[model samples]
Structure formats: C-alpha cells, structure tokens
Target: MGRLPEAPLLLLVVTVSFLTGPDVHAGKILVFPVDGSHWVNMNLLIQNLHAKGHEVTVVRTATSWYVKEHAPHYRSITVTLPQAIVIEEEEFFVNFLMKMLEIKKEGVSPIGFMKFYWEMLNALSNIHQQASRLGVEILENRTLLQSIRDSRFDVVLLDPGLPVGVLVAHELKLPTVFNVRWITSGEGHFVVAPSPTSYVPTSGFAATDKMCFSERVKNMLFYFLNTCIDKLVVCPHYDRLVDKYFGPDVKFYHLLQGADIWLMRVDFVFEFPRPTMPNVAYIGGFQCKPSIPLSPELEEFVQSSGDHGFILMSLGTLVKGLPTEITSEIAAAFAQLPQKVIWRHTGERPGNLGNNTLLVKWMPQNDLLGHPKVKAFVAHGGTNGVYESIYHGVPVIGIPLLFDQFENVLRLEARGAARAVDATALTRQNFLEAVQDVLHNPSYRSNMRRLSALHRDQPLRPLDTAVYWIEFVMRHKGAAHLRTESYKMPWYSYYSVDVCCFLLAVLLILKAAVVGSVWFVCFRLCRRRKPKQE
Candidate 1:
C-alpha cells in the first residue's frame, strides 16, 4: 500500500513546495502621483516597495518635486490632460450632492434650489473636463499600460483624486489600492478642494450630526445635490467606461470597493470614532519615518540655542506668506516668549523680533524636531508635520488654519501631547499662551514621549507595513476579502435607527389595517341585525 501511493505523495510534496516557495508571485506595481501630496506619498511608497523587493514604475503629473527627489533613478511617465480640464470642479459637485443626501430631516428651499442649479451647471462643466482628462490619461498612457500588462502588474496603487488612475485600475483588472494624502470626509470627499465642508466630516470640520439648525439644513441640501452628481455624473461616467470592458452589470463604486486596500493618512488616535470599512486601513504614520540628516543651517540653529531652547514656528508650504495682521500677531507672540524662537518665516524678518528670536525662510523639519534644543513646535498641524513631531517626541502648539487642523489639535490636546491656538481667532495672548503651554507643561512632553514610543515601537516600520500589505494584495490574486462590503448598503442603511424605524413603520401599518377591518366587520353585523327597523 505504501509503495503504491508514491505518485500521489510526490504530487502532494510538489504542491506544498509550490504553495510555500519564496518569490512565488513576483509582480510589478503601477504608482500614480496626480498632485503634490500624491507625489510625496507615492515617492515614499516607491522607495519602500523597491526596498521590499518589488518592481515599481511611477506615473505622475509633470513638474513634481518628489519625482526629482526619490524617483530620479526610476522610469517616470506624466499624465497628459488638456488645460481646460479641472478635477476640483467635479469634486465640488460630488461634495454638494453627498451633503444634500446625508441629512434628510432638513429639506431644501427655493433660494437653495436656485443656488444649487447654478452650482450644478458649473459642476457639470467640470465633470465634462474630468471625463475628458480621464480619456486623455488613457490615450497617453496606452503604451505604458501595455508595457505594465506585458510585465504583469499584480495590483495598481491609485490616487483616487484623479479619475485616470481609477479608470486604469478597472481596465487592468488588477486590485486597486488607494493612497489618500489629504484628510477625507468619512464620506470620502476631500476637504481641501473648493467644496463645502458640511458634507464631509474630517478631524477639523464639525460632523453633520453635530451642526446647528441652519448649517445642518444647508449641508443636508448640499449633500443631496452631491449625491445626484455622484450618481448621474461620476457614477455614470465610470459605469460607461467600466461597463465597456468589465461588462454592463459592473458598477464603478463596486469595482472601486473591490480595491485591495485604502491607506489613509489618518490616525484613529487623532480622529473621531466613526464606523469604518475593513478595506479602509489607517496607516497614518507612514510619513513619520525617520530621516536623513538635517540641513546645515537648521542643525546649527538648534545647536546655537542654549539651555532655554527654541520654539519652532511654521505654517505649512501653502500658507507660509500669511496676512500682515496675522504675521504681526505671530511676531508679537514670539517677542513675549522667554525661549529663543527660531521661526521658519517665509517672509521678511520683522524689525521687532525679540533679542532671542531668529527667522529663516526654511529648515529641514524632521531634523529640527530631532534636535535636543528644539523644545516646542508651532505648526499648522498638517498630518505630515504632526507625525514628524510625534516621531521625535516633541510637544506641539498647534495653530490650525483650515480643514482638519482643529481636529488634529483636538486629538493632540486630548492625548495631552499638544495645545491648540485657532488661526482664525489668533492674537498675541493666545499665541503666547499656546507656546507656554506646550513648552512649560511636562504633561505634554510626557504624553508625547509615550505616544512616540507606541508609534515607533511597531514590529515593522509604517513604511514596511504599507509596502508589505500592498504586495500581499498582489500576491493573493486580490485581497478582495479585506475590502469592506459596507458600500453595498445605501445611505439609509448606515444608520441602525433607520432600519429599526422602517420595521416599526411596517408593523404600525399592519396593525392599523387589522383594526380597520375588525371595525368594518362589526358595522356590517350591526346593520344585518337591525335591517327590518331601518
């Protein structure tokens, strides 16, 4: 019997070896960078993927600095679109519709209807451009796609902001992985684009359920308007393309939902608790990787500061050159601080800078955070900066400008790792108070160090986790199981109360019908009994 089974045994051994062997499924990944944030995030992903033994080719919008920095040695292709096309405009309409649909309690009005009509037309023009750009991206990248298919891409890492990447992901049948560089509303609308924040809930913007009457009504209308755009405009456009290749039954969002992974730049520790889909993985600290050496000027600046130390100030790249009133107040705040203020000011150094204060246009941020003399950080609380500070265990004084800054600061404050100063209502007193609170408070520093330990103490670095999961999705044929199926539920399905209310309404209808029938029967009986007298 043992000798007779030799062939089967050999087959079993071969199957086991094939299943467990190293490099069983070597595959390539297509990376896209449609914006500055995309460029940076994608560049880092490329580096990590390359290090983890995966082949990568980058496709990006032209003139990206990240291409210069990281992907210099790798092959890079640019997305081509006409100048008239704008993606943000489509985003606005998509946002407006979503907000309108989310809050059904507060209905729409005549003025709102008129405003929505104008916005919808404007949004329609944008959608036309977006569809046009997507077509152009396909045409330009046709040869590139052919090459990727020839080489065999197991999965596509797409930037969801751009329609081109999603279109390509669908075309290739490779599992798509989304990398979000900005804070997305739990609903997925980006807050940075020219749209009302009412529909989308991110860290800084207030959630829909919590808004006042007027704002809630306004946002609800916008959400309804956005839902129409998503259905009529975005969904239809995607459906036409997807159905052309994937068959008529396939939906655009369904295909997107089937994506392998969604790596959001968010920390639950820093954000509010909202129900999340399984496929949506929050790898927020990806940008918090330890870095190369600091710039010579920044290193020297830190070294020059004595035992009193320095307070570092910066408002991200976009809003660096702010209004004069704000700058004056910031300067005033610096003038009051006991510590030396090494400001990364993008404008001229004010004549009234404190004796201890020094102004420089730019500094290597991570390097500055790593400096022993850097006592506190004043940042816009951009995800990148917050994580960098957290990575180095430095307390932060947040002056949030817009978007999720408030949320970021709130999270930090809740954790006792930072203090917040509102940029909109900023004054010298508030600025000075925040600075003192961050620098002088031992609790902030202690909590920061504790969180830094938890963040840094991961079995593998965030980059490694990101790269590994991406390849895992590719190797597994598609990590379809990791995707959240919650999208199948309609807008109403998200709320359990809605489901209960629906059941309750059905019960009430049945009860009322039964009671009416009983009453009718009783009346008929009474008429039959008294028929002669009538």
Candidate 2:
C-alpha cells in the first residue's frame, strides 16, 4: 500500500488509538449503598462508571433485598448482621404504610399530622438504630477492615440517608461523595447548606417556596421536628460509634457534611430554588434515558388503546402493593376511565379491576413513560419515577406515601404538571376525578413538556455530570477545596450569633457615648439655667 499523506496518516493514527487503545482512566471505587429504589439508580451509575473504565465494589448487607450478591458491573462484600434491620423486612414496611394510610384518613388536620409523625418517629428510630450497626460490624471484623485498608480505594460513594457509609469512609480516610437527596437529618441541603426555613419548606411539609407567615411557621415547626428526629431518633445510634472509633470530638453530621462531593439527586427544575454549596452538584434525572423499543407483547398492549393514550402507574420499588381496600378503590377508579392502564403491582388482585387495566408484578417504568402513547402517570411520587415522568414529559397523578414523596408531587403540582390525591381520603370517586382531570387537562402535559425541555437544556447530561464529579474527586484524592468548614462550627458560630451580639453591643455603646456627650455639652452651654432654677 502507498504511504498516506501526512494529514491522513495523523487521522489514521488518531482513529486507531480511539478504536483499540487504553481507557482514558481507570479508578477503584468503594460504594456503601442503600438498597431498594436507591440501589436502582446507584446501579445505573455503577454501570456507567464501569463502562468508563472504573472498577466498583459495593458493600451490602447479607439480607439486602435488592443489592445482588453477584453482578457484572461491581463486586459485592456482604456484611452479616444479627438481624436484618427490622425495617428492612417487607412485612414491616407494608404494615407501616398501611397504618400511615389509616392515620391520614382523618386528613391534614393537626391531630392527623401528629399521629403520622408519631408513627414515623417510631419507624425512623428503629431503622437508624439498626442501620448504624453496619459500620460497627465492619470495624469489628479485623479481616474486612484490613482488606478495605489494603484496597486503597480512590473514593467512597454513598447515600447519606442511612449514613453508615460516612462513618466508614471517614475511618478509611478516603474522600467521600454522597449520592444524596435525603440525609438522616432531613433534606441533604439542611445538613450541608444554609437553608432558610423562611422559604425553603421542609420535606413532607408539602408547601412551596413562596409562603405566607403562617406557612413559614409551619415550615419552621417541621424543620424543628426534623432536627429533633436527628438528635433523638437518628444521631444517638451513630454518635457512640463516632466516639468509639473516630473520637467524641467528631460530630456525626459533620462527617456527613464533609463529603468531598454531594451529587444531589435533584435539580432546581424539580426542586424549589434553595441555597446550595460549592461541593453540591445537582444531577437530577441522571438515571433517565431515551426509551428503547418495547417488547412485542408490551407494544401490542400499549397500542391496543386507540386515540386515547394509556396511563402507567407504579408505587415504587418497596411498595409491591397497597392494602386491598385502597387497591380496590383505585381499581374501580381506573375502570371508570376511558384510557387503558398499566399498573405495576403484586398481591391480591383488586376485585373491581377493569378490563381496561393491566396489572403486572413488574414493568419497564422508564421506557413506558417515554412511549408516545403514555398520556399520564399515576405514581406514589418516588424521586426516580417523578424525574422519569419529567424527562418523558408525562403528567403525574400523585399518590404520595411518605418521606419527600409528598414534597416531590407538591412541586409538580405547583408547576401545574401534576395533581396529588390524599391516600387517606382516597375513594373511587375522588381518585377517578383526579385521573380524569389529569387526562383531559391540556395544561398538565404542556407544563411537563416545558419542564422536560428545561431539564434537558443543560450543557452536560446529568449522569455524565455525576460521573465527572465522582471522577474529579478520584483524580484529586479529595475535593477539600470545594468542601465547607462551616459544618465544623458550633450552631451559634455558624449562624453568626456571636458576631451579631458583638455588633449590637458596639452600637449600644456608641449611642450611649453620644447621649452622654450631648448631656455634658448642654450642661456647659446652659449653666445659667441651673442657677436661675435654684
């Protein structure tokens, strides 16, 4: 063959290098992930990271319901516990959901609200007490501890909701990255940023950013409740462990806030505009992608509905099914609709289930949402599902369960992209009205499409953005420059209470000196007045 020209020769070399060359970089990552729906998104990141030449190893509990023992994308290390956290049991969560639904039946009054949070406190306390044991178990195991130390893992990625990962990462002396939305304290921002309760509504408050005075009061009360949960229900579990291994001087929330990068699972598009930190990177909808072709059978089912499009419904990963009564009401409501329904549910079949509805133990929720024929989404307002609904421009009829789900749907409702139905007050009639309104409503779809456009009009894909930050931490060893030392400050210091007090004292002294000078000058100038009075 003739020798190529210089330009062509260079191009050929570049092409060859691109085709059969070494990866741009390969880094070792250690992950301590929360299971269930959280793991679903985490697994997506792991797959993408693996594709980009990173090696991932996950630390999971032996009793994990979703984090598999074997997977191609990552290796797993299972920690044995005396008992799987009581809250991890399927039965416990189902029963908890059922009871919460019952409590909510009285509606949004103070008595009903108190009953809900009281039950939440009980479950939240138990989950944290059990979850905090994972770090201790790892530390107690000499072999595991030594092995982890020897691995020289580049970074630790975790969900701070459970927060055991933060403790373990701190002990390992590795840079930490949080795949965060909720922290044990509440919303991740409350732990890591300057959140003003004046406008930034606390999770589950279901209030929007623009609030009246009374709404702000409720927001503060909700915030105070979250802080109490942290101090009373969540912190004590991790505090002793911090004292034992890390030292008493180390604050637990400080460890959480100190993560090198916070890959927040929400964007301003979905979340109300709030204060954020340099270390926090919003990567909402990172798990979303363009839909792929549906299976033949599924496609036929989807196409069966004529001009009236279908609605996809799912309660999320942990909720396999609702109580029979709720399901029956929902099913009856669906039966009244003209649109066909695909519900991802498993359990006793609803007696009133309509011919127009299809129930499955599982469904491709994301792909189905992206389908052109999907008219609306009936969901429990999970973060993942909500984001997918936005990404695909599908309006939502939200059935919020607990823990930020309410807030998620409330945001969509605020945007005119969704509607929320109180599960406690759920009835066939009410549910049917909400669904029909969403279906017929042109505003909902247009609003969601606009959100989808805004969400998509970014310089970088959210997933790639997340991967870049994760790799950014790995390359630098730590992102200390981006992290805030504010987490280490006392509350008074953090809020500048001391500075305010000092300034106030100086102002008072200046005023007092001026008053004294004026009095003295007046006495000197008007001395004859005092003599005349005598």
TM-score of each: 0.74, 0.93
Over the stretch 94-205, how does candidate 1's per-residue lDDT look in tens digits?
Answer: 3553443332224578787667666755665464455445545664567866876786777888666554566677667777787774421223523212234443443334
Give lDDT: candidate 2, residue 238: 90
The candidate that achieves the highest TM-score relative to the unseen native structure = 2
Question: lDDT per residue, candidate 2, 1-534, as tens digits?
Answer: 987799989998989988994335699999988877888889999999999989899998989988899999899889998768764577776877877777656457787788777877887787888898898899889999999989889999998878898888988899999998888877888888888989899866989999999999999998888788789888998988999987868888778778899999998899889888899999999999999999998899989998888999999978768888889999999998888999998889987999999998889988999999999999999999999999999999999996779889999999999999988788999999998898888999999999999999999999999999998888888899998798787889988999999999999999999999999999897996888889
Give the lowest summed-lDDT range of ten residues in model 1: 183-192
C-alpha lDDT of all candidate models, in order: 0.66, 0.89
In candidate 2, the residue pairs with backbone N, CA or C atoms under 3 Å apart (3 or more residues apart, or in different chains) clash, namely none
**Runs of candidate 1 exceeding 4 Å displacement:** 1-26, 63-65, 69-73, 84-135, 140-144, 181-204, 207-250, 290-297, 348-351, 457-460, 484-513, 520-534
Model 2: how large is the Cα RMSD against the reference?
Answer: 3.0
Top lDDT model: 2
For model 1 the TM-score comes to: 0.74
List the candidate 2 regions with Cα displacement exceeding 4 Å: 1-24, 106-119, 521-534
